[model samples]
Target: MDFFKFLYRSRSAFDYADDNPFGISTLLNAIIKRLQQRRKLTLLLAACLCLAAPCYAHAHIFSPLLEAILPRSSSEKPQASTAATDTVTSDTKITLPTDLSNPSTTTAPAVELELTKQPRPPLSEPSLYALLDAEFAANRGNTRRALVLYKQQSFKEDATAVFERALGFSLNNEDVHESLDFAKSWLDQNPDHVPAWFYVAHLALKAHDYTLAGETLNRILRYDPRADLSEILIGIYPENDDDQRELLAALQPIDSQQNASLSVLKAGLLNQFNDPQNALIHINRALLTQPDYVPFITLKADILRKIESTETVLSYVNQARLRNPDSKNLYLYEIRYLLDLKQSQQAWELLLKAQNRFNDDNEITLLAALVSLDVEQYRTADQLLNILVKSPAYLDQAYYYLGISAERQQRFEQAKYYLNAVVREDLVLAAREKVVSFELLNDNIEGAINTLQLLRQQYPVFAPDSYVMQADILWQHNEAEKALQLLTRVSRKYPDNELILFARAQLLDDSKDYLIKRTLLNHLQALDPSNLSYQLSYAQLLLANNRSSEQGLELAKNLIQIRYDDPRYDNELQLQALNLLASNALATENYAQVINYLQTPYDVLPTLRSGELLLRAYQGLGADEKVEALLADLQQRFSFGQRNVNDRVQLY
Candidate 1:
């Protein structure tokens, strides 16, 4: 029988007359019969009745009714009505009502189930099996279904694990916001998880939440003291100096003693801001703990160098070498220190030691070659450069230095070959200039001209310099008119070109055409009125033409006095002025003044012309012994070709 028929029979047996006045059984029977015909309509009425009643009313009303209609087997045990609650399934538990006769126990007359008050049951093994399905789906690359399953499982059991899986899947699908939310929930469950913290910190950094990132990093460090966060922090370059300072300040509370790498990074940042003094303090602190750490030592040395404590730099680098004897970089640092101190020989020795230790290292080889070049050890430089040229890392620089080494050794052809091999754009013009110079030095005038021409065509940026070089070569070949014409043409093309104008003036001065020379010099001076070199040239021309000898002498004397009074004045200017003064004095037969002017030092003489004039002044003063000594000194110090003593000694 259906529930309604059983209920009606039971009610009839109990109190059939008054309690059943409403005929609940008859109505229930009608509903049941109708449910067979219209099941949807029956479900709708049952849902409405269930919603309309209180939860305790349903229990009080149903318990006795169910007990009366459903006969229990002898083996079946009855549940106590006083029990508060019991589990129904993995997803649900139901609470039983209190004593129905108690007024306080009474609920609303309508059946209203309060499922929210019941404690949920723990997920069963079937839910775990569903989690496995989620894993499989995720593995199968069905991320959408897997996320839904994982989320549903989170509400069931092991929410941390569920959230972690969801996060992993979300990240795999590149759903960053979802992944972040899942990660946050997972971390909330397990805050001490280091890997999770790393993701949080990384994402925080990406989001530019530096404070949060720093806190996360600190938490990670507390858990694992040896975590290397130096690279991560260093990679975060701020937008401005203030932001960088703020970042460094944020990191300062972390113990530098525990992380020396962080200290070194801060020192580097400080050095970049030109705060070498403070930078040194941090670097030294790091070095104290990590004396054998090569990078810290190198940073300390660099900071000291920036502050210009050369002796201290040398001492620090030497100490670093003792601690890290096998460190090639320390050796390089020492070499660089010595070179900066102008102790070239010491630098060369250190470079050789570095080469022996790191025989295959190209950087050491390049340094050795460059230092050898500096100390005039051409053969050693040449050998090192030959090895360096084979390595692409140092090929162009090696070729450039090899050319210089060969040129120093007077191997012009080899120098040209090496120079030509230099293809680095920065080195090309310099290499071409050297090639042209070497060609001229080798007495191949035509070759020099050809090289300069090619250089002009290939590197038009250097065309003006090439033009000047070509003019000089033509002038050396006694082709004065050709040289002058070349200078004129280039000067017109590059009117403001000082080099071309200077070359033109020189040719005119050589031809003794003072008027045109003065005009060109005036134009140059007009272009740069403050140019002392141009002023000196103009004065020299004035003295040469004897047009304004006294005025020229006075101007030259004033220039020399200016150079003497102000040590910052150009040495070349001082030399030129002295040469002019001495020449004018010699011409005027002012032997005493000439002696006073030129007797400062032989080193002070600007050129061979000044030296010759000094000698003539000594001759005019009738000091034969002084003359012979000066003559011998000049002949030994200078290469005066096959000219007689008088011819060599003649100024102009």
Candidate 2:
């Protein structure tokens, strides 16, 4: 029974100029309005209203609430006494009609309801006394106290009227646990009551007790074979394997009915449980039931993804897309799967079809642009990105990609213009850095430095990286002294900056300033002791210093001792360390030890440094034939600028 509607009808039509005097609260009205369809507990409700009918003789409680909230066997009429409230059976279940004749519930809460004790003569019924104030508190917006009073008057023996009212209050409060507990109590009293079972099953679902919900749903279906349980079933979410298994087992009876939506839900649950084999069985069953169902179609693809190859999955998705041409999600999935398979031509063709069908959706247009670029369709990428640039949301990214497309086509001038137009802070730095590459490619060192300086000016956090790049440009242009000066100036400003210091030390070493380079490498070690590159630099610098041969040899030996299994050891580092050891031995004229160290490194990588060291070792051992053979190999393999191997060995 919709008590709120019945309460609405009870308000007399005195035409009081837009006002309702019954004082019904909105919270209770909204919660109770959903229950108007169940027409089976009007008898107990009519008695509850009959008590109020005499109390507020002005309310004119004339609505058919008596027979609606408590449904009878159609042969028996509602009696004045509460004698029939003791039996909990199908005949006693409340079934409210959905017809609402009055709009008082919406207008009632504005006027305060004061059903004080001086209203009427005393009655033996205690619930009648409390009901007056309960309605008063409800209209006053004190829903908690109103619900407390409603629950107080509602007992198991003869409490169907007030108990359902209390259940409505509990729903308004959003107390799922409390509602479930109260629903279980009401169900315990009324074992065969469909309305009670309906509420109990839903509350169990809300509380995430899927086993109890599935069991109660079975009972509800037994009584009312056409009950719509879509709301309750949609809320099933199992958190783990055990919960999934329990819920799946409980739903066995429901699954045996072979309903389409239920089969799909079960299939989804099985998929989430990672049992794709069983999930496929149920999804296939659903497809058989409803062949064109989109969810069933997509779920089959998802299940196949776990067991099938990408080619097979993409074939299935393409077939589904062909069948459902208007499905936007299918188009998106097809594009994604085709891209994963590296079939960009197919993806591009599908995207063009989607663009035509979808009227050039901006997101799809942007995706098409990226795909065109991937497939080297420069003209198509340019066209799509140009359109996307008109929209504010996609403007920043559009300009950025337009720059990349132009740059890839060797349109350096146009690339710089488009990239420079990107004003987004995240993309601006990368865009300007690309411009620097274009400048350097044109052999314009000044332009590259100027661009880097602009970046440093705009984004100070990246100033150190920009400064390092500037120094590299000078060093690459054969201006070593100028590069050293720039690094020295920046290093002074950022004395503790490791990147600048490392760049400065490399420049110093290349300029043959070993004393300063060695000092800088030592300071770097103190800053970050685990820096293996710095350690390698220190060993190489010491080996080059004639006076520190013993120290250099010991450090090189320590470095080479790190085995292949060690995290600190990589092939390049080991080879570098070996070259250092062999160089130290050759310096000391220990030809035998030099040969032993250089043999493995020469075999692994015949780099100029290792080859040159081996040639020196062979010469120091008086193995003239080995020295000549090694020199011939080095000449064949590498360029020595204007100094060929024969010309260079004349110095030794």
Candidate 3:
């Protein structure tokens, strides 16, 4: 404690004043204070270097770190009296005195050392204060200042709390990438911290850096094998099949463990990807650990349902139900399979049994009501729905289905009242659409439009779809000009809305208004070039240019060349493109070209238009035998009811 005052000494005082020093403790304190006063944190710290002799050490690389840790105050400022930032205070050889006690050394110190019995904390004073100031700055909403302090605090010690605080602030600011960096820093100091690992996993998942996410989640599982992963799993939302595949790959290492929950999750994802065989492999892996796990069994049954017949899957579900009679999922699975087989009576009976066994089960009740409606048992369906409508959780679904029940009974007014009462975001659109359909049935065009307008106001996210529906209803009611005008006005408000643009394009092409194609269709195509509908519409517009338009032909040909070879391309869109090409050929009186395009469509599955085009091409080529043979095959298909040609054809 007495040695602390010598920390303010010059090099002469440090080398001579402690000649009859208390020991090494007093000598090292002088050297440490000398270096610290100069605001230099030397790599060869004086405390370590001064053990052999009275000396200072080299200083480099840690200057900024020491400056940050030094207390911020005027009194603590570097003294201008000392300019020598040297490692050794003197070149003269010096010897350490052996005396451990002296009257001068025992004198009252300039700074009192009040040593209380407080437990040692993780960080020293300066580093700890840096964290405190960092938090203060954060609470004051000065994020940049707080981050600087947090980073400074981290430099002095393995201050895990400071890294955690920085991470919290970064996340609060929605700076996901920064939060992830802080999270990694936190784990670097304390690798075993589960919460820090979870933070890393969450941020990695958000960035779609699935490889990092998988690695972090694997570390978390190693820390706590039974850790709850539901929150992390829920954050993953795959928007399409490709996204789902990526997410599945990310979860592979996690599910590879012998954990039933993880295995079931992977199996469920594989099933959704429609890889039923792979799904079966993972589900069976899960069942090995928890053979009678109801959800796992249910998933296995579902995966089999994709490959096996409805009856076979139902039998497997029935066997599982016998083993786990109390499981609600088994009952639901059996009922679904029964319904798929069109055994409505058996489904209703099974639902009744389920309802009795699980008397308070709302799911069984809902399923029963739906089955009743399917069988036209309207009174029974209404009774079940009346009960569901009382539950807060099921209120929206109840109202939506009750509306359908009423509509089926031709009680349109009551149905509208019920449907309009649905408030759930998921169900509201369908409910209102059903009400609009009722109005349209009675030639009530204005009422239908009003319903759609109200829907748009109630749910702005659905505004584009509502506007498209309104235009469709108007055009259907012989108000094509009004439909065109309504879409045009809406397009100005939502210029990027493809649905509105598509509807407007349809109206324009129908009314021979090809002039807007250059601006409207070009913008629409550029906005989402991958949208097959836009490509088809744009192709149709070009082909409408005197029927043999080269641009239209090239686009249609390019569409086929690019997408036709891709195994994942939508078959319907490919067929539609082929139809557009055949239509162009027919327009150009190139009968042979028409046959070339329509031949595949006719052989695979012909819509009326494709069949007609092929027939016309045969007749034009004067192939009487081929034309007669085609007629005989078409009549046979219609007679045997092998194919049902769609009546409403696309103009393209």
Candidate 4:
């Protein structure tokens, strides 16, 4: 039903025609006209045959098109009648006949022939209406039939029945165009039908058609007059000056009666068109009208989520769930929010609660699979995603992640098989981009580069991540100048991108060419004012260039204070700062400062240089007793051989 609804309520390509229509009107109009013609013929044939055989018991000859469009059934003669609107049954069998005129060729026995020529069965074959009734009665959860029926008979006044069927179908199939068309037509014919137009407008906007969508919305306003279509039209029709005025005029007449849910939806649509700031404005405005609107809160949360405000998003989504605990979408969204915040334990706990709530829905299952994958529970993630892959909504994603899980488990052959299932261009390109990383890990340099080459061709404008990877590999292989040249070109091509700029600066610093080492590091620091690594590196470089007093000590102190828990914390940087400060104190012969610095132990480890540094520091302080004692301990720690015990020690 959602499929057909999607089709009808969907704006014709004419709405998007820059100079010409979107070019889909011909196909759609053709389907509509064909259905109309078939319907009229069905009526004429049924009426004529009934009148001609007045003496004979009559059965309706249903519209073949209508019957064909319904769920195929063997138990019923395909016919259009409201008498048998049962849920479609799986047992309903249908075999399309090559010859309609030759009735004997089909398994369906001739009704007249059986009535007059032989003993009649206890019951005549069920009419198409009866079959449809059985289908509706079976309640097999077939939503497609309702959508097809509406699309088949939309021209008739009796379309209300078809529309009802379509509405039922729409609950299960959100993408059904038939339900959208019927819903739109239903609203136009019955102005009081609010939900019909609501869904129709939603489908229209999603399909990117604003013209007829505006017309359908105008019909809604004619009844309620307070329905705000302005924001939606403004978002959908940015270039049209008149639409804004018309939308504004419509809103002014009945502004007090506007619904909060519709307004938030409009704002969300605006956000889709790169108007997030304005989107936030509209959503906030809706909140002013209905302060406790859960949908509006969720919409705002979604907006914040897109901007990477994980904490804010979690806060708002939690508020929404508190207000409306039954909202499946909010629960599912919160699970993702927990994952982004790295609260994986909390995420798993919420996932269990959601499963119990939704009765193990496929959408929730897929969401759980994603969270499991994130936390490295590959086997459990595989089991959940395998079931979801059967659905088209998540099929491609399932294949990609299944490939990842397989690779993690060292099932390389299985991983490749799963990866090969992703046929979507974007997914395939992303998979190809990953190929180099995996190949290089497996020690296949040529395979890695070849994979990267193919990826670069497909994603020529994808910001050249492969170039950085390749340059790093080259640097490790000792092709220093070539590595530098590659990074330089990449930086030149994408100057505004911080990653390339940072990489280029690091490469130059590593080149050991002092002439421009400070200059390059300075440029990188300026480009990214808050880059802790570059700030610290610049300090180290300054000290190495004999500029410790000029700025090195102050810069190093600032770097450590700013990034107390930064991931790039290096003991060497801290030691350099301390060593420089201590050397300055000794230069002035400040014995107290020297003693204070020496008291803070050097970070000695599995290194002879650190031991030697410790030995030198003790001797400089003239603490002979402490020095002799430390050297004895060091000799025992790294002893060459056993010797006679003596109070004397030698330093060569």
- Each candidate structure's TM-score, on Cα atoms with residue i matched to residue i, is 0.52, 0.51, 0.58, 0.39
Candidate number with greatest TM-score: 3
Output the TM-score of candidate 2.
0.51
**Tens-digit per-residue lDDT, 416-519, candidate 3:** 99999998999998888888999988989889989999999989999999999998998987898999999999899998888898888888862356777657
Q: What is the lDDT of residue 514 in candidate 2?
A: 82
What are the runs in model 3 whose C-alpha is more than 4 Å off? 1-131, 143-352, 355-364, 375-377, 391-400, 406-520, 523-531, 558-577, 599-606, 623-652
lDDT of each: 0.66, 0.70, 0.68, 0.56
Q: Residue-wise lDDT of candidate 2 within 1-652, one digit each (tens)?
A: 4554654554432233114334333323432443334433453454355435434644633232232234332446635334332333323333421211110222111112122212332322234435545665665466666766665555423456566666765566535656677668656645755566667776776577877888887776565444455545544566677777877777766743444556677788778778898888888887875676676788898899888888788888888888888888889987987887788999999888887788558888889999999999999999999999889989999999999999999999999999989888789878988999999999998899999998889888888888888888899889978988998998989999999998888887623798789889889999999877788777787777662567666777778888989888878887888887777777778888888998777876788888888877787777878877877777788853235655566544
Rank ordering of all candidates by lDDT, starting from the highest: 2, 3, 1, 4
lDDT of 1 by residue, 245-360 (tens): 76666666765555555678678878978999988877877777667878787887788888866777788778779877889878877887777678999989988988999999
Error of 3 at 361 (Å): 5.4
Candidate 3 vs candidate 4, lDDT winner: 3
Candidate 4 segments whose C-alpha is farther than 4 A from its true place = 1-326, 333-363, 374-377, 387-396, 413-434, 488-498, 509-512, 547-549, 563-652
Q: Alpha carbon lDDT of residue 450, candidate 3?
A: 95
After best superposition, candidate 2 residue 69: deviation in angstroms?
A: 11
